[model samples]
Target: MGSATAQALVASSSALNAAQGITLDVAGELFSVGRLIGESTALSGALADPAAPAEARTSLVSRVFAGASAPVQDVLRAAVAERWSSAADLVDGVEELAVRATAIAAPDADIEGELFSVSRLVAGNADLELALGSRLGDGEGKAALVQRLVGASLNPATTLIVTSLVRQPRERRVRRLLNRAMRIVSAQRDRIVATVHTAAPLSAEQRSRLGAVLTGRYGRQIALNEVIDASVVGGLRVQVADDVIDGSIAARLADLRQKLAG
Candidate 1:
């Protein structure tokens, strides 16, 4: 992220935080605005143009998002009023705000965990991933497919988030979109996500201890997204962002085999 975009994100996030009585409706409106802006290069450029007056950008937001609720409009105005490094960054900024809004509205739901699960599902199913992420498919079809597949099991907030993203992926792969949403949701809660792969699910106490250890080391709250992979054989493989801690028996055997062969 560029310096300007980072500053703009903080500003927009603050504006979202200040809004009272945030609801799923607010998140829907923000997503609608983000999608419209992302689809129009001209609009995004005009809004994010550094030379343009901030007043002009905010006025454009009012004209374009007139149908949005007051809170949504307020957040958009705040976003356009700041300087972004690029037009695409402006669109991403709005999308982040929308994701954060969804996280806020669903305070009781495990947004990161649910999104991670969706990502795993997509990663494991090639046909399903192609169907959802293919550019040739109509947005409505993708949205309906998403609803039919996971809507029943997901929280209302999660269903709304998944449906909205599948409808307008904007060239992101399904896994990429899901992971990005999970990252934003984790950041919104002031936590980081650690994906743990093990032969079996971790016990609640094990999970707590792992989270505490990671939090102490990283100096931030840690949210674990556990995956049960039988191929792990034993032990755990944990990843946070780019860093990996691989202790799985499969990895150890592979290392030992490579050493003996050399």
Candidate 2:
């Protein structure tokens, strides 16, 4: 994220955090507003234009989202009031706020885990990914497919986020969108997600020990998203942001091959 966008997101996040009575319904409404803005370059541009008067920009938000709840309107105003790096960044800022709001509303739900599962599901199915990620796909149809696929298996908050994202991907691939949502949810809880790949599932005790070690190293809670990958051969490959801990046998074998070649 650019500095301007980062600052804008921080401001918008504060607005969301301070708002009272935030609910899943409010989160849905925020996503609706984001979808509308994402679909219109002109609208997003007008809102993000640095030359435009702040009052005018926020007034547009009020006029357009008059039906939104007070908190939604407040967040919208706060978003447009900032100087975004780009129109797209403004749209992203709003989406992040909506995700944060969902995380806030569903305090007890395992939203991060649900989003990771959905990410894996999309990554594993080319047709499903294409259906949801392709620009040519019908937005309504994509949303319906999401509802049918997830049904009641996921938390209501997760369902809302997935359906909203597929309805208006705004050129983001499905996996990217899902990953971003997971990251936002993790951030909401002051934690970071560690994507761990292993030859087999980690036992509960193993997972607990790994999580504790990572938490201590990072000085923050660590949420693990475990992936069972046969290619890993043995051991674990863990990624937290840009840092990768590659102790997997596959990586070791590759290193050995490189050394032999040298």
Candidate 3:
């Protein structure tokens, strides 16, 4: 949620626009870097520090990503050099560039990962989600937080995906932004984003059955994202895009108890 994060993502998008013929693996690696930077306050703070020697920060980036592609390295250096409003802003610029490159690198794989990550962001926290998705905060603030989150992950594709989100209208909430993003990604690649939350991971058989049920009901092919949520207790919560099918035992018991009390 720092300003540098936003600038990083925006810078990332610009980098991706300049990138050509990047590979899927490269895109994934870049996204990982962006996410790492975004999520870790220490790392972002170090990089965003004006007093910190540019050489030192750049050197750190190089050492960390020595084995990465030349393009990715360039993107990282460029992002750090850019004068982001805050550490969070740094993340935004870098991530934007990364995702665009990833979309070009591996359309199918990148779209899935982007949707999954964005949705996960929505599911992560309430205050952050609201702040990023609210009109009360300016684009600069939103961009910063998004950048940090995506920057740590460092996928060119992830960056590109996040950049688009950062550019949307201010009225959208984080969850809505994620949903809209999932739809765009799905449409681009002819896939569906089905977010499934459960007490534990679904078995292969369960996934298959659930996939079939969702596909039949929605009339679209889906890529299932299984999110393990221990708080759900004994039941499963299946979210096929916007539609939530929660059949958790805890919910049922609570419902029954409430009715009895009533």
Best by lDDT: 2
Candidate 1 C-alpha error for residue 174, in Å: 0.8
Q: What are the TM-scores, per candidate, against the unseen true structure?
A: 0.94, 0.95, 0.48
Across 1-262, the per-residue lDDT of candidate 3 in tens digits comes to 5555555555555665576557766666666677777768898888778887778888878987788888788778777765566876676545445445555676555566566667676677777677666667666577677777666674555555565465444355556655555555565445677877788878999889988988898888887887878878987887765688889987888889999999
**What TM-score does candidate 1 get on C-alpha atoms?**
0.94
Off by over 4 Å in 3: 1-105, 110-113, 122-145, 152-154, 258-262
Count of clashing residue pairs in every prediction: 0, 0, 82
lDDT, candidate 1, equals 0.92
What's the residue-level lDDT of 87 in candidate 2?
97
Ranking by TM-score: 2, 1, 3
Segments of candidate 1 deviating more than 4 angstroms: 258-262
Per-residue lDDT of model 1, residues 1-262, tens digit only: 9999999999999999999868999999888888889999999999999999999999999998888899999999999999999999999899889999999999989888888888889999999999998999798899899889998989988888888898888888989999999999999999999999999989999999999999998899998999999999999999999999999999999999999999
Q: 220-247 in candidate 2: lDDT tens per residue?
A: 9998999999999999999999999999
